[model samples]
Structures are given as structure tokens and as C-alpha cells.
Target: MTTRTLGRLRRTDFPYYAAHPDVVYLDSGATSQRPETVISAEADFVRADYAAVHRGSSVATGEATWAFEAARERVGAFVGAGERELVWTAGATDAINMIALGISDASQGLGSAELALSAGDEIVVTEAEHHANLIPWQRLAARTGAVLRHVAVDADGLWSLDEMRGAVSSRTRLIAFPHVSNVTGQIAPVTDVVGVAAEVGALTVLDACQSVPHMPVDVSALGVDFAAFSAHKMLGPTGIGALYGRAELLDVLPPARTGGSMITTVTMDEAEFLPAPNRFEAGTQPVSQAIGFGAAADYLASLGMSDVRSHEEGIAQALVETVTRTPGVRLIGPAPGAERAAIASVIVDGVHAHDVGQFLDDRGVTIRTGHHCAQPLHRALGVPATVRASASVYTDIDDVSRFGEALGEVRDYFGVTT
Candidate 1:
């Protein structure tokens, strides 16, 4: 929680910062740097015990399966989900797609009636959602004859709880939104939205990709029907993520993917699928990646999420202060001193975001540029692109200072005058 503890966290746990001592990494919103424990966990598993899980009754298979399932338990518990409620997918994008595709199947009378979307049913999303959350529901609405509506954002790229409530109506079937905006770093009022969804008998799906890593998130506590997040963003390996659904809902929702491991019995004519998590996990699983994901969860748990949140809060404040003090730099999302995630996306008045990124890169400061996969959000904000500097548990005051110093020079370096 102190500066000393933050220093120890970065130096002792993360090797990426040590290796690139001069480079300031401020892109943890896109993907986090892994701890040594996570890297070792994956390598150690592959080196000592590598086998196809649940494919056979061999000792190797059993051991591999145990490790894989145990990883699932860790991740589920980390998110306040029962083990049965978590389904592994390729990543958060894939997880959202799975839910959309499964709902599409349900609309076609393939799964439980409760999840079925009939003609004229409405699906609501926010204007600030990342494409992963937006596009999937767009496809689902198109496929199911459901109407898609969105809660609009203001000039600052934020939507209010009242705006969200206004978007929902009697015909609303589902409400899908992000826990935090990937572009603007605005934290959505999740509990308020969940309450609104419940009032209308609408299902809630949360894109927790940005929130789960930076703060404490309990899917059950939030009362969302389903939530998705990726491991890579949370200091774990790529190619793995989790979809959390209520037990009863997951039990009935059809698996979007069908293959070998997820089956209970296969016939020439039909197949009976396993329940919940297993039914959703088809084909060969990401066994080693799951182990690494579990290790990442353990590492964060050891630090305590409360402390992690506290550390990032300070970083967020520093980032806001830095951006606000710099002339010709427009800070997106919440204003100075407002609560937000540890991400700062800004637009330099005269320079393109890519040019700003290049300027920073030249100064050994790393940041994300362009629309950051939320083109609609950028479009709404009336900008083509913006540069984003995000922080993680490993990011310190010096990192933010380096970013600030580099950013303050961006206009001068480009010969752009206010």
C-alpha cells in the first residue's frame, strides 16, 4: 500500500520492468506484464507434467486434468464464482462471442426457453463499449430478429445511470455493457445497471476485461447474469479467459462450441452435453495457460486486491494530475479528482495520436495509441484516435512521471503550438 511496497512489488515480482529499465510501461490496460511465478508455473507444468487432459484414463492424463481443474477453481474463487459457473474460452472476446452465439442458438429453439430471444425483443448496450462487447451483441440481434439499442455517451464519453435506465424498456431481453470503458477509463455503475436490468427481467452481461485486473470484482455481488474477462489483461498468459454465469443460467445455456471433451454421450443422430463449465469447454483445453492463470490469481491474492486497488488509485490520481496540468492535452473520461480506473487517454491538440505515441516511444515511454479497439467510442468522442497511458500494480510514480515528462514534450517535439 505504501510507496516502498509498490517498489518491492515491481522489483521482486515482475521481471519485465527490470529487463527494460529505461522503458516506462503504461499499457497494462491492453495487456499486463506477468510475474515470475506465473511464468514459472507454466514452464514447470509443461516440463514436468504435460498431457492431454480428460482424453484418457492414463496417470498422466489424470494428473494434467487435476491441475487444469484446480486452476479453474482458483480463478472462479478469485472472481467470487462457484467452480461450476466459470467456463474457459480463448479470451474475453471469444467468451462474449460464445454467449452471443449461444443466445442465438437459444433464439432458434436449440436451448432453454428462458434464454430465447423472440422477434422484436430488444438488446441494450452502451455507446462506450469495446467492439468485443458491441459487435457480438450486434450479430446476435441481427441473427435473432432482436432490436439493438444503446445508451448514449456525453461529450466526455460517459453515460449516466439515468441514461442507462431510459434505454431499457418492456421489450428489453438483455443488457450488455462494460464494467469499465477501455477507451475513456470510466467506471460504469454496475450495481445500478444490474438493478435496472432486473426490473425489466433482462439478462445482464458484463465486459469485465478492464475492471477485474485493476480492482476487486465479485460477479455474484454485482448480480450480473454473466461476465467475461481475459487472463492476459490480468497478468496471466494469453489464449485463456473466463466466462462467469449464474449456475442455473449456465446449466441451461447451449454451448456455442461443440466437440470431444464437452460431450456426455455421442450418437450417430444426437449428442448429450455435459453441464455448465465442461459443456462450454470443447476441444483441447489450454492446460498450461490455465495453470499460469491460476498462478497469476494466486500472486494477486497474496498482494491483496484492496492494496492493489489502493495502489492503482494513487496512480490514477497522478495520471489525471499529469494530463490536466499539461497544456493542449485533452483528458478523456472523468475529470480531475473523479473516480476512475488507472488509465489516462488523451488527445494532443495538433498531433495525431500515432505521432504522440512515436514521440513518447522515442523518449522511452510506452503507451497505446489509436482507437484501442473501441472505434465507436472514438467516433462518438469526435476524434479519430487518442493516446492511452494505463497503469498496473507494477507501475510506480516514476513511471507516471516519465510518461508525464515525455507527454509534456510531445507538442514541442512536433513543433505544434497552442
Candidate 2:
């Protein structure tokens, strides 16, 4: 939103911001702050109605089970998916690992032979991916004897459409990439990547952790076979994430983690698993957290994602212009006026990123400083670390301007004027 709306929201919805007037949080890319509605939804659910789901025949069990399933439907509709497409996981990392490990199991003759990977099959990824997205595929390759091919990023840490196209071929089994670069904030063309994968008869997977929270994302419309994202990043509670897969694909893919409530029938040696959402959810579900997540989705939906994108566009322009105008601060990612997410990652001329972060912290501003779990992207940019200031629905112009002023003073604070 614009400053007016952001300021209004700051006072009405966000308790943390209202309580701590001095602290300006600029780390929404890492994890967004929750609104009062989301906080109360979880607490209210736990306090008023807390019971095990899918295991009992009592009234409490039916009520709790209804709430839990209803939460999934709300979150699913938020992302433009059917009620059955969403599968609950711990977080984005767990969701990605679930797919990778499920593929591993398939290749090892565990469940669906249709999903198996051979020695010559290749899995594609971009160098801009975070470690969570990268490591899972590496392990999958190691376990299945498949080859991993990376679509390398350029000097600005970007993978072009041509580069992505060149990386896919007849041998490609899967093409997985992020919808947005967490470091560069460069938004990728989902349809382009999905088209390339479809041409090569490869399954498409999207690491939608960064894009889903900030902009509108429809997994089914994007034509991707599967997508993963985290609840915490979307202003929802932690310990719960979502994996959206085509019901056809999810039905056959082996469950990475197997336990009670996931199977339809279990006898002596052989057991049959349930369908999509239920098959993936094994143990007692994260009932309260999912309810909170649904409330978060409803909150965003009420504001409208189109308005959210328009608001972030303003923040992106401000962040880029602020960093570039300040001396000793080099802005990363696309040039000004380019299509990018509302995240500003910068490298100071002399001071280290951690020191820059501390410098901001001293001035009552909080930012994220490090490789951002994206060592490959950092290495591509030839930097050890960067200080990233990201924006969200509640971020105002004052927050961005404060970050710019603090960043400009970092070199001077460390006596690095030269």
C-alpha cells in the first residue's frame, strides 16, 4: 500500500509496530510480521477448541477436524488452487524435501514407477536458488543416479529466458526454480519456464517462497506440476507450510514421511495410502497453526493481492532510488524501474554486511545481513554478504527512508570515508 494506508495499518492491525514505535522492521523477506487477527486466530482456536483430528468419533474430534480441513480450503483458495491440491508440511524446506525424497523413493521402487528417475535423467535448477531449494535436488540426484544441471546466473545474479531454455532438453525429468530471487528480487516468468519444461516432457516445480507472499500466484494457472511455500513468510504462524501439487501427480508420488492417519488400510506387511492432501499429512496435524494460516490468507485476500503488488511497487521504487542516491552503497539486482520484488539488498563500499546490520540496529532499525541462505547467488555477485531491507504491507516510507539514512552513514561510522 501507499504510505497513507501503510500508516493506517501500522496503527490498527499490527500490534508490534504500534507498541514499539522506535523499531522499524525491514526484514519481511525473511519472515513477515503477523497481524492481530492472525495472532488471535491461533490462540482462540487452541484455547476454545483443541482436539485431535481424524482419529476420534466424538463431537470435539469432529469440530477440530472440521476446523483443520476448513483452514486448508481457505489457504488453498487464496493461492488459486482446488481444495484437494494443498498438502501441509512443516515449512518450505520440508515441502521441497518431501518432493525430492518422494522422487528418491520412486526411483528406488518404493511406490510409483512412473515417477522414477534413471541415471541419464537430469534435474534442472538455477544458481540463484536458496540452499533449501538447491540441497534437496542435490540429495535427490545423489540418491537416484540422476544428473543435476544448473542454469547459471549472470553478473547481476539473473537467469534469462534463453539460459533457462538452453538448460532443458530431452533428458530433463524436472525443472525447478524460484519464482523470484530472494537476493536480487528479480521476478521470473513462470509461464515461460513451464512452457520450456512442457516442451521437454519434464515436470515443473516452483519454489514460490518469495513470490507467493508479495504477489498474486496461481499454481494451476502457472501450469506447474508442483509448488512449495512457507506460512511464516506469508504473515502466518511458523511450524506449518504448504505444498501444492496437481492431484494427479500427488496421488501417485510416494509419501516422504509415513505414519498414522496417512494410510487407508494397513495390514501386516502392505499398506495403502490415502489421496493427495491426506496422504501427505501423516501425524497429528498442525491444527491451530493451520487455522492461523487460513486467517492470514483471508486477511491478505481482503486487502486484495493486486493492491498488495501495487503497494510493493511503490516500496521497490523507493528502496532502489534511496540506495542508489546514497554514496558508498551499491544496490543489487535489476536497474531502477525494472520489474522486481520490493526487496533492496545492498553492499556498502567498505563496511562488512554484519557491521552494516549492527550499524542499522544501533539506530533502531532491523535488517537481515548475511548470504541469506543463497551462497550461490552471493558468489555469482562476487560478494561474501549483503544487507537486505525488505518491505511488506505494513512498511511505510518512513521505514525505507530510515534504512537509507542509516545505510549511508555506515561507511562513515566505520571510518571508511576513503
Candidate 3:
């Protein structure tokens, strides 16, 4: 393999191992590679501070409890949310499920909220959502006898703002979409979308899985009823994620998964639930992961999200230019130089995405391939799948250049180039 070995990543201020001089990772959109600090933080918790959080009695437990809540405050500060509004879950999928399950419980008489769903009620989503955001809404509509409507996307996998505006009517009860489409890399105007939904008194849910990790996010400014994202994508451990909801709203929503920790009191026939966050957390929380995630959030903050965003944008721009000049390559999503994230999904003519990925791999370049969990967006763009190269804060110009060089050879290897 042609090696693009940079050197020891420790030579740089960025905590991640970017200078391996042997690897060029480009799949940050799916999950980012962790820094040494973030990785060690998780290990530190298990090796030393392994007590249960929020419900323990021992002195060690008390210290652990303080650490746990401190982690909550850190995450809250990073995302522009408050401790009262945040509920911990397993991941973005788990968080989304929590919201849907809570709403479903409300409709099914488990909650205090006046959630009355009929066949005429509608739940709106976009064609560009990951399955995590789409499937839950589909299940909610199925269970509530509500209709599901989707805002269509353009040929570039961009959803029309006008169509989304039209989709919201009196019948629309809830709307859900991603802050940034994972496949397309296009940043959605979240405030605009939420504003429209708010106008009609519809609840809004945002899948912030892509945005929270890459850019500075202020959930308060988004003005949505709920938002969810995973810790792993943001360089934390896999088992922890967060769901942010309005304190007043979560107060009325019922617990989805019930057990020991989530209850206030229990009787043989009836049980009273705890407050918003604890009521939803239910079982043994991901205490160690939360501690580690707090460290990750702190690390990102230290670097400043502004710096990280600018670095990845530079890589994306360079990758876009390289793709445009390469033969038989069609860039997916918005055109190059458009306001986008670090991801670039592209199709190589006469080659399956898997083959393109394999070709890149043989040359020591790592890029993500396939539908990227947004199959609807792929279909709308008229491709079965695409090879996606996503950069991260640690990614530099060399990695992007390697990806471009490898991609330029793909058409020739597949006999697509004249």
C-alpha cells in the first residue's frame, strides 16, 4: 500500500492521533476518532471512580455523584442547554426513541399531557433524515392513527424550505428533521424550520447527531421542543447520549422505560414517577460514559468549536475542488463551496460504492461507503449508494489530498474513464 504516514499525532496540539503517518481516516461523520485525553478519561472512571451515580449512599458514591452531575453541567454548557432540560440515554437512537416513546405514552394515557391523536393528525419529516429520525416518527404515526408526511428533497439531496413550510398546516402535530443531513452534508436552517413548526403550535424534534459533534450548537437558540445526539459521534463513549427537552414539557411526559431508579414511589397496584431526567433514565445510567463525555465536551471547548469548524471546512473545500477536477466523479449534495459540513458523498461511474471504498482502502485511505443510513436521500439523488469522505477536527490537508489522489484513480481502475 502507498503509505501517507504523517508522523506522531502528539507533535500537534490537537489531541487526536492524526499524524500516524500510516493512516488517513475520513469517516468522522459516522463516528469520530477519539483523542488520548477523552479515551483515558473513560478508563479512569472505571479504574478508580466506579460508584453508581445519583442514587448512592457511600462516601465514594457521594464523590461519584458529584462527578456525575458535574459532567451533566459540562454537557449542558457545551450544547447551550441546562441540566434540568437534559436526559441521558444510550445514544442518539435511544434518545429519539425516548422522545417518541414519551409522546406515545402521553397519547396512550400514561402521561399528564393532553395528547389526543386521531387519524387526521399528522407528523412531518424530511426525505433526508437518517433512519433513527424517520423510523420513530413512522411508529408513532402507526400507533396513534396519525398520517405521516415527508418534505421532498431536490436532486442535490437538499430539502426545499418552501415545501417544508407548505407541509405545516393545522393538522400537523409534530415535525422532525436533522440539523445537518448525514449523507448530503448540507446544513439545514434549523431555526427557520423550528420557527415554521412553532407558528402552527406543532412540536419540533431535531436530530442533532451531526451538528453537535462538528459545530458549536446552541439548543436554546434552535427553539425546538426536543433535540438528540450521541456521545460517540462527538468523541465520547458509545453507551451515552443526551435528549434535551423543555423542562415544563418533560415534566408532563411519561417515562418510556420504567424500573428502580426512575420511580419516586411504588405500590402493588400503582407507582409515581420521578422528575423529568431521572424518570426517563430508568435503569443503571451510563455513569462512566457520561464522565468521559464531559471530558470530550471540555476538550472540544478548549480547542474552540470555531477553530474545529474552520479546519474541517477547509478540508471539505479542498476535497470538493479535487472531486470537480477528477473524471467521471459526481459529487452528491450541495455544490462545492456551498454552506455545508465536512462530509462529501460522491458517486464514481461504473463502480459500486463498495468497490470505490475498497479501492481507496487498498491505497491506505479510509472513507465511508453505502447509503450512510439515509437511503431515501440516496434514492432521490438517483444513486444506489455513495462513497462518503468526512473529515474531523484532527483531519488536515494531507488526508484530504490523499483522498483526492485515490479518487482520481478510481474511474481508470473501473474502466469508466476514457
Candidate 4:
């Protein structure tokens, strides 16, 4: 199999593909296999520089803190954010919750007036959002008495900017949505949506989990107030992710989780917190994982997202054409020739998605099957689950061809004539 369009990924760089010669892994949507550089970065840091960050003043602590902040800078640069804009969290779930919970704190009059969410205000989201983005806002609205509204998706699990305009209003306080859909791979109109939020004086929160790793995403360019993504999705460690906020906004917003490292002064009753990132990062930080994720971001920057995007575009096109050309295989999301990410979720006519996934797995073509944490979108599409095959920089034409040919044989293998 040929490397489709990029140069930074030699199969040797990724230990998983190098070790397993026969497997065609197509599940990059769930998590990408870590490269040797990212893996080695983590191991090297743990071996050489493992120490508690932002606590002690010892030499070892200094080095560890330096590495941690260096990672923050590297990752910030990768996402077009300033050093002060990032706050590391457990993952995207935690990152989004950080913003939601902090806003909830505002609703309680515990934070600055910028974040205050009163009873009459509203929050806007899209129907194509993952549960990670959807549920938190639902909780946010419930907690603050704010109205929660969603831009509906069409039959293919896609929504348009015009539809989004209809959903937003002058009373909107926050607009939470995804940059790219995890299930359908539809890229959102970030600039336009941000403009929409701006006109209404609403804040924008982006679920960048599906966008950050696969493409070159600039938080500044997108004009989003806050964006969240995970390290695991970007070929780094699993337990770490980041929340990027506008420096000014984060400065005034209260920390969601409070404790030692995040606070400046603690009295017997009240504790005054730090600013921005320091305020948000509560306890001991994810030091080694942050280093690894920085290395991962460095790796992607080295490859250049342009090459990666080119590689995936070809794969996306092939996947769309392949699935749609086969009978009883309904391609979900934007049709071929549309601006989509490297993801294809399909509903096979006669077989369940789980069975389709297992059938492909037996043939050594690994794919993800389920609601993909997007049950609302699936419900909109009139399906319970879908077989989702997503591509990454390492995915090649041979892997693409294999999945298509195998998918064509699924109906016959299951012995269904309908």
C-alpha cells in the first residue's frame, strides 16, 4: 500500500502499523494510533523529567514546569492560540464541562458579569453535535434556566448556515457547536457562525474534537471564544485534552474545579483563584501526556496539515463513491464532491451495523459501528447505528479499496435478498 499524499508518516514512525502488517485500521475517528515520536516523547519525559508542576520551587520542579509550559506553547501555536489561552483537562468532555460549569458558576453570581447566564437567555447548538457537546449545554440550560435551542439537520445529518441563523436570536447567550461532525464529517461554517454569534453578542464554544487533528484549525481565525479537543484523537496520550479560550474571557471566568494550584490566596472561608489557565487547572497537571501531545502536534505540523488534508480528501471521496455505488449501502452525510472531512458513516440495508463491523473485522478491515455518540443525528437519519470508516494520514488507496470490496460482499455473506 502506498502512502496517499503525505511525507511525515513513514509506517515505521507508527509502531502499530509497523508491528501489524496485515491489519488495515480504519477507525481513526475513535482514536488514532500513536506514532513512535509521540510515544517516545511521553516515555522520555517520564524517564527524565517527571515532577509535579506549578507547586514546588525545586530544580526538578522547574524543569518539569518548563516542559509543561513549553508543551502548552507548542500546542497553542498548533491551534493558533496564545500561551495564556489554553487550559488542560481530562479530555474534550472535561474541557466543554469546564466552560459549562464555569458558566453555571456565573449563573450563581460567583463569577464576572461577562459570563452571567440569567433565566431569559438562550444557548444554541446544532442537531449534528456529539453527546459531548450536546449534553453539557442541556445541563447548562437546565442549571441556569436558559433556553436551549438546536439547529436541525437534514436527512443526511447535515445542517446549513441559513438554518443556523433561524435558530439563533438576540437573546442567545452562548452558541455551542462542533467544528466538524464526528459522525457525518460535515465541516461547519465557523467564520459565519461566529459572525452570527457576534451579532447577537453571544459567546461561541466549539467542539473541535473532530476538526483539530484532521485539519489545520486556527481558533483565532475561526473567531471562537472557546474550543476543545483531546490528545488521543490527535495521536497523543488518552487522558489529556485542552480548552482554548479568549485570553480576556478566561481571565474573568471562574474555575470549574477549584483547589491548590489554581488559587492564589485562600482564607478560612473564601479562596481567591488565579488567572486564565492557572485558574482553570486545579490540581497536579498531566505533565508527561502534555509533553507527548505537544510532540504529537509537532509531528502533525512537521507533516503539514495541507498534505494530510489532501491525503484524506482523496480517501473521503473514494469512501463516499464506494459506499454509495454499492446497493443497500446508504452513505450518510454530505454527498461526494461536497466539502467534507475524511469520514463516511453508512447504513447497510439488510444487516445491522454491529454485524457489518464484525464482518469487516473478520476480514481484517477494522471500522467503528454504533450511534457514534450521535444518537440524535442517527435518529434524525432514521437509523439506530451506522458503520463508520474514517481515514487518517496513513490510510492509503489499498486500504480504501479493501473496505469497499468487502462492504459490497456483506449483504451476500449474510444471505439477504431484500
Candidate 5:
């Protein structure tokens, strides 16, 4: 790894990064700060190569199709999936919805007529799921008459492996869960969970929104049936993401949306959909954004996920130490020393999460403050929301220290000193 390829590790050169001498950003889990290369790549695509892909026979269409499919290959390489296994979607939310919709279609005589879900079948999730993962399964269960079941978490927001193991049974149809929790920073034992599900002949669905961007994720090696993630979280442009499913599984699953590019032949009463990726990616795709996403993936690959994970761990450890030293501050999620992400959620004595966010903002430190789309987890943890500070590859030690100092002053600002 050459230093030039890695670029300067300092907090500079970050696109949309305005360095106030005292300002710091820590809300990377919500959305990461993009680099200049990613921004320029998207701009260049729009400026030089904007055209409708997978349609028409013109030279421009060929170029556009090449760019779009090349992005599929780039993103596929990043996650250890094949080019044909990657399907473009609007975002992670859309990807999850697509999976739910595909399953619904499979059950409803749209495609794969042999596999139909009915009442008494179970769909498993966890108590710590984000609404994106939770609501889709809720609707799937309700619509298909399948019962929804979930593994419970303890007070620390940690769920035991045995708890999940016990939940799987012959009736379990699918298991949808996050590889890493957004609020708790808790890393789930996906392999173990998948093992139990496989024993019951159930499918494994992973919400890799947090894991794929930050770490080196090999979906094939992980043995997941399907996985979903967004581009913006990994320094790519928004409105673009990818879903990876086993080639065999996607070939049989029907796409949620139907349109021009997704079909091969259509008659008055019947239609034949395209193959795995094309079938799911209906209509004109996000070409420019996909191009930019490929660049982002390339950049991250150049940096290497091992280095990214190590650097992020350094920041997380320092931030957790600072939180523990601070008075009247309570750190939520997995305990320190647990395998987790660089995200840390905290609650201050006599201070609301929103108020703490405002206080941090006044100090020029940016952090996320909310339920983080994990309302059920918050409800289980006995709080409405929390203040979260997350890190990315662009983040430096100085940013972590600045945010820690700002956090130290929070209790004093609210006069909740212990």
C-alpha cells in the first residue's frame, strides 16, 4: 500500500468538509463524509457520459450500459459477490423492501409458484432491528399469514447466541437481522444464527448497511442467502445501492417492480422477466450514481478494510474511554472491549438526547441524536433515543479528541455534574 494511494490521513481533503479550527464531525454511522474523488467522479459521469442504459442500439447506450454494468462488477468485487449477483436499487431501504416484495411475490403466484408461504410459518428477527429491517418483515408476515418471531436482548442490549439458537424451529421460514446494530454497536454472530436457521431449512437475510461499508465483507464466504447495503454510507453518491443474493435464489425470485428493462417478452396475459440482476432492476437505473459508487468502492479497496477496521477501532476505544471518564454520562450498547463498530451511543444525566446534540453542536461537534431508526430497541432499553458518535476512514484522532472534549463539557453545560 503506497502512501500516495492512501492519501493524507489527516482530517483535510474531505469533500463538504469545512474545518472550523474547533469543529468536528462524528455522525458517520448516519452518513459518511465523501472524498473529492467520489464527488468529481459523479460530476464527470453526468458531464461526459450521461445516457439511458440497457436500451436503444445507439453508441451512447452502449457506453451507458458499460458504465452501469462495470459498476456492478466493481461493487461485486468489493463484497466478494459475482457480477451477476449484484442488482441495483435506490438505497438500502429500497433493497430491503425489494427483498420483502420479492418474497411476497414468490408466495402470491407471481413467480416460483411452488414456494408459497402461509399461516403458521415463522419469520425471525431481533429486538434490535432498525425500522428498515423490522417493518418489511412485519408487513411480510401480516400479508403472507406467517407468524413473526424475534430473539430478545438483555439490559445491555446484548442478545445471547443461545436465545437465537432456541428461536429457530421447523416452522421458521426466514431469518432477517443486521450484521451490526446501529444503536448498540453490537456485532451479531451471524454464522451461528445462520447455522441454526439452516438446520431448520430457513433462509438467511442480512442487513449489511453498517458492516459492508466499514469492513471487508465476503457475502459468499459468510454463507448468507442475501445481503443489502447503501452507497452513500461508503462515501459513494446517494440514490444508489446494491443487493446480493445467491444466483440460484435470485433467478427464481420475482422482482417487486415491473417495467421495460426487466422483461424479455410480454403478451396480453403473461410476461417473462429477465435474469437475476436485470429482473430486479426495473426501469432506467441510477447510472451516474452507480458510476460514482464504483469509484468509491475502488477507493475503499485501495485503502484496504483491515487498515480501516484498525483505525476505526483506535477511535472507538479512545471515545469509549473518554465517555467512561466523564461524569454522569452513560454509554449504551455493548460493553467496552466487545467486538463492535466505531459507533458509541451515550446518555447524559438530566439531559435529553436532543438537548445533548444541541450542546455538542454549539461546541462545533457534530453527532447523531435520535432513536437511529431502532425505536423498538430504544423502547426495550428504556429510553426514547441517544446521542451517537460514529467514525469513518476519513476520521482522525484529532476529531475523536475534539468530540470527547466537547462531550466532557455537556454535563457541565446542563449542570448535571456528578
Candidate 6:
């Protein structure tokens, strides 16, 4: 299927693709290309309304605060969260770390006991998790004496609901996993995982970096305790992401970061902090980046998430077909007919992934190579690395076709014919 048939966005909408019309960008899983509106939103804010938010009583401060809070509301509503439920951070990695460190504080008696971990308690994760989601939990487990347990993946690098169910038990305190795998393009059984976690009274933390930018995600509807996603993965600016927590949980999650702006009153001996978001946001906020994120959300909403999903469905099919049809290529994710995100990771029979990447780069086909920050998953897959191609709203059929053609020529270019 073609992107034209599925109704995709024009490349002209994005400044990067507009400037490099000959380049076929397929790296959206890492970071997306921003639309002109999102860029203008940030630039315009910097030029006209830039000021320190949540401080001082000047008119400039008031306008800045209003814009900042308005952006929060826009982003929250986009993901089915209330205004207070979303907390801004540096990125998804920072958001996950905040949650982990906050829970660590809880275990140390800094906050409410609802999320506190203790010796012998289990923190469940999957083998397919991104390092951002996995390593934080590992550190938390070490700090609290909790055991870090994981659901192992199959030969295809995909974890099943049964595996997830088997991993959680009466001692499970939290379950951390991705909504979609960055390496395998596998869509996780989130609802099933959430159900299993609920059965064991475990909190669910979703790494939504891959899912939110590609499909419709409702953290509340999904029944997760927390979710982490980056604005850059969804066509917004970098250095700004969101942590979606249940309002009650955020209010008591024990701020991992504390400074000016987060507290209402501070004494030499102790301090009293504000509620939810303010408790999490310390120091000066990312005001202009937040506005750009809100603009990206609005742009996607206007384009219709359903339409975006439909378009990516076509892209996924094309990607799978391309990999399956090419000789000497092994796809790392779901089978050709199975449902997946618009991502394809593959290993050429003889050429290294980096070599494949270089060959494609020479053809103006940009892609991600190496472990892709999934060393454990690559070890499990029995390969050192794989080249990954991902799509976004701006990607089209021609871009994918170019990728397929370049990929087909790789083995021959390296003189690897058997």
C-alpha cells in the first residue's frame, strides 16, 4: 500500500524534509521531524512572550505563566489526562528516573507508603524494555532491596501476555514495560499487562515513547499509574517530555528534585511543597519548548489520530513486505502479517548493521544502526546489532521504497554472494 492511498502529510510541512527534498528520512523512532507550526510556535514565543513563569507579579510573568499553564492543559488533554496529572521533564529518560527516584524516596520514608518498596518485594519488567525503563527500576530495586524480575522474550524478541502473567506474583509492587518495542516494532499487550498488574496490586509504568507518536494513547483509559513520553518523538522540540501520573499519586510521589518554585514555604529545618505538577517541576521550566510541544499536539489532533494510525498501518505493511521480500535479510520483530508499529529492524546475512547503514546513507536513506540502545535485547536475539527504519506522519511510500532499494543492493555491494 502507498502513503498516497492512506493520505499522509506532505514533506513540505516539515522544514528539514523541505530543505532536503532528496533525502529519505526513516528515523522517526529516534526523533521526529517537526512541522513548521511547531517551530514557529517556539520561535514566536521566544520573540514575543518569553519570560520566567510562576515567578514575580509583572504583566510579562502573568502572560508567560498563562501560556505555560495553557500548554500543560493542551498536552494533558491530548493524552486523556487532567491538567494536574502531567509533569514536564527534560525527556522520557528523566521522567522515568523521576518516578524511580521518587519511589526510592518513598521507601526511605520521605512520602506516603502507597508506593514504597521493601526487601523481598518484586519489580516486574520485560526483557524487551528500553534502557530508560529498565535501568531505573534496577537502581530502585538495589536501593530498596527489592528484587528486579523480568518476563523473558521469545526467539522473535516478543513477549507474550502469558509470560507477563507468569512474571507477576503476590509480591509484585510495580510493572514497567514499553507500549511498543523500539527494536522489534512489537506492540505490547498493554491492557493484558495492566490487568495482570492490577490482580497483583502492582503499579503499571508505560514507556510511551514509541506508542504515543504513532497511535492514540489514553493513560487514564489504559489504567496505568504512570506514563513517560518525549515531545521530540511526536514532532515537537527536544529537552521537553511529560510524565503522566495519577493526580493522587503525583501529589505524594515525593519530589526527586526540589528547589525554588516547587515549594510553598521553606525553613532551615524543613519545607512544605505544592501539589502535583509544581511539586515535580523545579527551577526554571522549559517554557518555549512546552509551547512547541502543545503546538505539536494540536497539529496531530487537527490531522486526526485515527488518520495518522491508518497511514502508519500502511507504512508498517510496506516495511514488513520490503524486509520479507529482500534476500539475505532477517526481520527482528513480528511476522509479515502481524500487527506492529511503523518500524523495521533487520540484520543482513553477512554485512554488519553499521555497514548496511553506511551503504544506505550513501544513497540518501537515513536510518538507525548498532544496538539501538538495546544491548540485552540484541544479545537475546543472538545478533550484535540491527539496522532500524522507522516512519512518522511525514514519511511516505517513496521514502520507504528508496530504503528497500538501497537495502537490496547492500549484500551485493559488499561482494557477499554465496
lDDT of 4: 0.90
Tell me model 3's lDDT, rounded to 2 decimals. Answer: 0.85
In order, candidate lDDTs are: 0.92, 0.90, 0.85, 0.90, 0.85, 0.92
Candidate 6 per-residue C-alpha lDDT over 160-272 given as tens digits, one digit per residue, 9 for 90 to 100: 89988888899999999999999999998888888999898999999999999889998899999999999999999999999999998998899999999999999999999
- Among these predicted structures, which one has the highest lDDT? 6
The lowest-lDDT stretch of 10 consecutive residues in candidate 2 is 3-12
Instruction: Summarize candidate 3's per-residue lDDT along 105-174 as a digit string, tens digits.
Output: 8888777655556677999999999999999989999998899999999988889789999888999989
Report how far off residue 79 is in candidate 5 (Å).
0.1
Model 1 lDDT tens row, 1-418: 6643684456568888679878888998999999999999999999999999989899999999999999999999999997699999999999999999999998899998899998899999999989999999999988989999999999999989999999999999999999999988899899999999989899999999999988999999999999999999999999999999999999989999998889999999999999889999999999999999999999888888888889989888999999999999999999888899999999999999999999899889999999999888889999999999998888888888889998999899889886
Supply candidate 2's per-residue lDDT for 11.
46
TM-score of each: 0.99, 0.98, 0.95, 0.98, 0.96, 0.98
TM-score pick, better of 4 and 5: 4
The parts of candidate 3 lying over 4 Å away from their true place are 1-20
Cα lDDT over the full model 2: 0.90
Residue 134 miss distance in model 4 (angstroms): 0.7
Q: Per-residue lDDT of 197-278 in model 4, one digit per residue for the tens? A: 9999999999999889888899998899999999999989999999999999999888889887988899999998887888
